[model samples]
Target: MIKIISMKEEHIPQIYEIEKSCFTIPWSKDAFEKELKENPLAYYIVAESKGNILGYAGMWKIADEGHITNIAVHPDFQHQGVGTLLMQGIIEEAQRNHFIGLTLEVRESNIKAQNLYKKFGFVNEGIRKGYYQDTGENAVIMWKYFKE
Candidate 1:
């Protein structure tokens, strides 16, 4: 049984492990630490099962919008609804905080992630040219609106 819980400092190590497995340019432990310790606008959630982290997601709640920072599921747990659970956690947090909308950027080549976001009502808003430093890939900006 997987449960989505608030991401505490203790969860960073496992979240970092998932980040490394999921991204070409993974965030450093220090970054996660800072977000958990000092970033006032950031909020995160983790999916855990039997004391093991299966995935994690985070966002920055700025004004009336929630900017999704990252979402990742351990490769072994992908396609098993872990990502969806992480997303649900983020969305619930956003709604609870009265966010008017949510936004994220995804690699243009990552169709699976795009599809997942689409399932949650995120629509293509625009493109950010050469947004990824690692690969110089354009990012597809997506948004999900909750307010008029």
Candidate 2:
């Protein structure tokens, strides 16, 4: 049973666990804390099972653009619709705010994530060289335009 909810302070430890498990380079607890605390445009959602977080997604709204900051699912929960739920939530939030579109950067090697975004109508827009600091891998920029 998966539940999606607004990311709360109490969920940070579980979120951190999923983050580290899902990504080669995970964001630190301090990063999440700061986003939750200081960033008014920060919107985050978490997928939980029984009380443990299984996945999470976040976005930063700047003017009319919604920039996805992160999205991940626990390895154990992969292909179980956690990523879809997290993304649906993000899309709903973006629509609610009247954003023109949503955009994100995924590692070029992350085919699964790229495919997932494509399923939601996002198209590749460009690339950023050396976007991943730890790996020096390029990032694929994808965007989904939402027309009201």
Which candidate number maximizes lDDT? Answer: 2
Cα lDDT tens digits, model 2, 16-128, are 98888888888999999999999999999999888898889999999999999999998988998889999999999999999999999999999999989999999999999
What lDDT score belongs to each candidate, Candidate 1 first?
Answer: 0.93, 0.94
Model 2 regions more than 4 Å off: none
lDDT tens readout by residue for model 1, 1-148: 9999988888888888889888999999899999989999999888999989999899999999999999999999999999999999998888998889999999999999999999999999999999999999999999999974
* lDDT score at residue 99, model 2, on the 0-100 scale: 95
Return the TM-score for each candidate structure: 0.97, 0.97
The C-alpha stretches of model 1 lying farther than 4 A from their native spots are none
- Candidate 2 C-alpha error for residue 38, in Å: 1.0
Q: After superposition, how far is residue 34 of candidate 2 from its true place, in Å?
A: 0.9
Q: Report the C-alpha displacement of residue 132, candidate 1, in angstroms.
A: 0.4
